[model samples]
Target: MVFVQYTVLGIFFLMELCALAAFSYWGFHLNRGWFIKILLGIGAPLLVAIFWGTFIAPKASIPVSIPVRIILQLIIFALAIAALYFSSKSMLAVVFLVVVVVEMIIMYSMGW
Candidate 1:
Protein backbone atom coordinates (compact mmCIF):
# COMPACT_ATOMS: atom_id res chain seq x y z
CA MET A 1 0.00 0.00 0.00
CA VAL A 2 2.81 2.36 0.85
CA PHE A 3 4.49 1.56 -2.44
CA VAL A 4 1.29 2.27 -4.31
CA GLN A 5 0.86 5.58 -2.53
CA TYR A 6 4.34 6.67 -3.45
CA THR A 7 3.79 5.56 -7.00
CA VAL A 8 0.76 7.82 -7.25
CA LEU A 9 2.85 10.71 -6.01
CA GLY A 10 5.40 9.93 -8.67
CA ILE A 11 2.67 9.95 -11.28
CA PHE A 12 1.67 13.44 -10.17
CA PHE A 13 5.20 14.61 -10.79
CA LEU A 14 5.22 13.05 -14.22
CA MET A 15 1.90 14.66 -15.02
CA GLU A 16 3.32 18.03 -14.14
CA LEU A 17 6.14 17.46 -16.60
CA CYS A 18 3.69 16.33 -19.23
CA ALA A 19 1.65 19.50 -18.77
CA LEU A 20 4.69 21.62 -19.45
CA ALA A 21 5.54 19.57 -22.49
CA ALA A 22 2.02 19.89 -23.81
CA PHE A 23 2.12 23.66 -23.42
CA SER A 24 5.46 23.89 -25.18
CA TYR A 25 4.27 21.65 -27.97
CA TRP A 26 1.22 23.82 -28.50
CA GLY A 27 3.27 26.97 -28.55
CA PHE A 28 5.83 25.59 -30.95
CA HIS A 29 3.16 24.53 -33.38
CA LEU A 30 1.24 27.79 -33.32
CA ASN A 31 0.42 29.08 -36.80
CA ARG A 32 2.66 32.08 -36.50
CA GLY A 33 6.15 33.24 -37.33
CA TRP A 34 9.28 31.71 -35.87
CA PHE A 35 9.89 34.53 -33.38
CA ILE A 36 6.45 34.20 -31.82
CA LYS A 37 6.84 30.46 -31.72
CA ILE A 38 10.14 30.72 -29.91
CA LEU A 39 8.82 33.21 -27.41
CA LEU A 40 5.75 31.16 -26.60
CA GLY A 41 7.57 27.85 -26.64
CA ILE A 42 9.80 29.08 -23.86
CA GLY A 43 7.48 31.55 -22.18
CA ALA A 44 4.42 29.43 -21.63
CA PRO A 45 6.17 26.76 -19.64
CA LEU A 46 8.27 29.32 -17.85
CA LEU A 47 5.16 31.15 -16.69
CA VAL A 48 3.58 27.93 -15.52
CA ALA A 49 6.74 26.97 -13.67
CA ILE A 50 6.80 30.33 -11.94
CA PHE A 51 3.20 29.98 -10.86
CA TRP A 52 3.80 26.43 -9.60
CA GLY A 53 6.88 27.41 -7.66
CA THR A 54 5.22 30.45 -6.18
CA PHE A 55 1.89 29.03 -5.13
CA ILE A 56 1.36 25.34 -5.88
CA ALA A 57 4.53 23.38 -5.21
CA PRO A 58 4.97 21.47 -1.94
CA LYS A 59 7.23 24.21 -0.65
CA ALA A 60 5.62 27.09 -2.43
CA SER A 61 6.77 30.50 -1.31
CA ILE A 62 3.21 31.69 -0.89
CA PRO A 63 0.88 29.18 0.68
CA VAL A 64 -2.87 29.32 0.29
CA SER A 65 -5.79 27.50 1.86
CA ILE A 66 -6.28 23.92 0.71
CA PRO A 67 -9.31 24.74 -1.39
CA VAL A 68 -7.56 27.63 -3.04
CA ARG A 69 -4.51 25.55 -3.75
CA ILE A 70 -6.61 22.82 -5.31
CA ILE A 71 -8.43 25.36 -7.46
CA LEU A 72 -5.24 26.90 -8.67
CA GLN A 73 -3.75 23.52 -9.44
CA LEU A 74 -6.82 22.45 -11.35
CA ILE A 75 -6.84 25.64 -13.40
CA ILE A 76 -3.23 25.16 -14.37
CA PHE A 77 -3.77 21.53 -15.26
CA ALA A 78 -6.90 22.33 -17.23
CA LEU A 79 -5.11 24.99 -19.22
CA ALA A 80 -2.38 22.54 -20.12
CA ILE A 81 -4.93 19.95 -21.20
CA ALA A 82 -6.63 22.60 -23.31
CA ALA A 83 -3.33 23.41 -24.96
CA LEU A 84 -2.89 19.77 -25.88
CA TYR A 85 -6.36 19.56 -27.30
CA PHE A 86 -5.96 22.74 -29.32
CA SER A 87 -2.72 21.38 -30.72
CA SER A 88 -4.83 18.57 -32.25
CA LYS A 89 -3.60 15.95 -29.82
CA SER A 90 -7.06 15.20 -28.54
CA MET A 91 -6.22 11.61 -27.67
CA LEU A 92 -3.28 12.64 -25.55
CA ALA A 93 -5.36 15.31 -23.88
CA VAL A 94 -8.03 12.80 -22.98
CA VAL A 95 -5.49 10.35 -21.62
CA PHE A 96 -3.80 13.07 -19.63
CA LEU A 97 -7.11 14.10 -18.09
CA VAL A 98 -7.96 10.54 -17.17
CA VAL A 99 -4.62 10.09 -15.47
CA VAL A 100 -5.05 13.36 -13.61
CA VAL A 101 -8.48 12.41 -12.38
CA VAL A 102 -7.30 8.99 -11.24
CA GLU A 103 -4.30 10.44 -9.47
CA MET A 104 -6.39 13.06 -7.74
CA ILE A 105 -8.91 10.51 -6.58
CA ILE A 106 -6.24 8.21 -5.19
CA MET A 107 -4.39 11.00 -3.47
CA TYR A 108 -7.50 12.43 -1.87
CA SER A 109 -9.15 9.13 -0.93
CA MET A 110 -5.97 7.72 0.56
CA GLY A 111 -5.29 10.95 2.49
CA TRP A 112 -2.13 11.76 0.66
Candidate 2:
Protein backbone atom coordinates (compact mmCIF):
# COMPACT_ATOMS: atom_id res chain seq x y z
CA MET A 1 0.00 0.00 0.00
CA VAL A 2 2.80 2.42 0.90
CA PHE A 3 4.62 1.60 -2.29
CA VAL A 4 1.52 2.25 -4.35
CA GLN A 5 1.01 5.59 -2.68
CA TYR A 6 4.59 6.58 -3.36
CA THR A 7 4.26 5.46 -6.96
CA VAL A 8 1.20 7.61 -7.43
CA LEU A 9 3.03 10.58 -5.97
CA GLY A 10 5.90 10.00 -8.35
CA ILE A 11 3.46 9.87 -11.26
CA PHE A 12 1.97 13.14 -10.10
CA PHE A 13 5.41 14.74 -10.11
CA LEU A 14 5.94 13.47 -13.64
CA MET A 15 2.65 15.01 -14.66
CA GLU A 16 3.82 18.36 -13.34
CA LEU A 17 7.00 18.11 -15.36
CA CYS A 18 4.91 17.15 -18.39
CA ALA A 19 2.83 20.29 -17.95
CA LEU A 20 5.92 22.48 -18.08
CA ALA A 21 7.14 20.63 -21.13
CA ALA A 22 3.78 21.10 -22.82
CA PHE A 23 4.06 24.85 -22.30
CA SER A 24 7.55 24.92 -23.72
CA TYR A 25 6.51 22.79 -26.66
CA TRP A 26 3.59 25.02 -27.44
CA GLY A 27 5.68 28.18 -27.22
CA PHE A 28 8.34 26.81 -29.49
CA HIS A 29 5.82 25.70 -32.09
CA LEU A 30 4.11 29.07 -32.38
CA ASN A 31 4.29 30.80 -35.75
CA ARG A 32 6.54 33.64 -34.64
CA GLY A 33 10.07 34.94 -34.80
CA TRP A 34 12.84 32.94 -33.22
CA PHE A 35 13.33 35.48 -30.47
CA ILE A 36 9.70 35.41 -29.47
CA LYS A 37 9.73 31.65 -29.60
CA ILE A 38 12.74 31.50 -27.36
CA LEU A 39 11.29 33.98 -24.91
CA LEU A 40 7.96 32.21 -24.61
CA GLY A 41 9.40 28.73 -24.66
CA ILE A 42 11.55 29.63 -21.69
CA GLY A 43 9.32 32.17 -20.02
CA ALA A 44 6.06 30.24 -19.86
CA PRO A 45 7.53 27.36 -17.94
CA LEU A 46 9.53 29.70 -15.74
CA LEU A 47 6.42 31.60 -14.74
CA VAL A 48 4.55 28.36 -14.13
CA ALA A 49 7.40 27.04 -12.01
CA ILE A 50 7.35 30.18 -9.94
CA PHE A 51 3.60 29.96 -9.47
CA TRP A 52 3.68 26.28 -8.62
CA GLY A 53 6.51 26.73 -6.17
CA THR A 54 4.72 29.59 -4.55
CA PHE A 55 1.26 28.07 -4.24
CA ILE A 56 1.09 24.43 -5.29
CA ALA A 57 4.27 22.76 -4.19
CA PRO A 58 4.29 20.43 -1.23
CA LYS A 59 6.07 23.04 0.82
CA ALA A 60 4.36 25.94 -0.87
CA SER A 61 5.05 29.41 0.43
CA ILE A 62 1.36 30.22 0.68
CA PRO A 63 -0.51 27.09 1.46
CA VAL A 64 -4.19 26.60 0.71
CA SER A 65 -6.80 24.01 1.58
CA ILE A 66 -6.66 20.66 -0.19
CA PRO A 67 -9.66 21.43 -2.36
CA VAL A 68 -8.10 24.65 -3.60
CA ARG A 69 -4.87 22.88 -4.26
CA ILE A 70 -6.68 20.22 -6.26
CA ILE A 71 -8.51 22.84 -8.27
CA LEU A 72 -5.32 24.66 -9.08
CA GLN A 73 -3.70 21.42 -10.15
CA LEU A 74 -6.60 20.56 -12.44
CA ILE A 75 -6.40 23.98 -14.06
CA ILE A 76 -2.75 23.54 -14.79
CA PHE A 77 -3.33 20.08 -16.19
CA ALA A 78 -6.15 21.33 -18.38
CA LEU A 79 -3.98 24.09 -19.76
CA ALA A 80 -1.27 21.61 -20.50
CA ILE A 81 -3.71 19.41 -22.39
CA ALA A 82 -4.94 22.38 -24.36
CA ALA A 83 -1.42 23.38 -25.16
CA LEU A 84 -0.69 19.97 -26.56
CA TYR A 85 -3.90 19.92 -28.55
CA PHE A 86 -3.24 23.32 -30.10
CA SER A 87 0.29 22.30 -30.86
CA SER A 88 -1.09 19.52 -33.13
CA LYS A 89 -0.51 16.70 -30.71
CA SER A 90 -4.08 15.67 -30.26
CA MET A 91 -3.29 12.04 -29.46
CA LEU A 92 -0.74 13.00 -26.87
CA ALA A 93 -3.14 15.46 -25.36
CA VAL A 94 -5.82 12.81 -25.02
CA VAL A 95 -3.40 10.37 -23.47
CA PHE A 96 -2.22 12.96 -21.01
CA LEU A 97 -5.76 13.83 -20.06
CA VAL A 98 -6.70 10.22 -19.49
CA VAL A 99 -3.64 9.64 -17.35
CA VAL A 100 -4.32 12.79 -15.36
CA VAL A 101 -7.92 11.81 -14.74
CA VAL A 102 -7.01 8.33 -13.61
CA GLU A 103 -4.23 9.60 -11.41
CA MET A 104 -6.41 12.24 -9.86
CA ILE A 105 -9.04 9.63 -9.03
CA ILE A 106 -6.45 7.43 -7.39
CA MET A 107 -4.89 10.30 -5.55
CA TYR A 108 -8.24 11.43 -4.17
CA SER A 109 -9.18 7.94 -3.14
CA MET A 110 -5.87 7.50 -1.39
CA GLY A 111 -6.28 10.80 0.42
CA TRP A 112 -3.15 12.26 -1.09
The TM-score values for the models, in the order shown, are 0.96, 0.98
How high is the CA lDDT of each candidate model?
A: 0.91, 0.96
Best by TM-score: 2
Over 1-112, each residue of candidate 1 has an lDDT whose tens digit, in order, gives: 8899889889999989999998899999999999999999999999999999999888999988777877887898899999999999999999999988888888778876
**lDDT of model 2, residue 77:** 92
* Residue 112 displacement (Å), model 1: 1.9
Which residue pairs does candidate 1 place in steric collision? none
Per-candidate alpha-carbon RMSD to the true structure: 0.9, 0.6
Q: After superposition, how far is residue 21 of candidate 2 from its true place, in Å?
A: 0.5
Alpha-carbon deviation at 39 in model 2, angstroms: 0.9
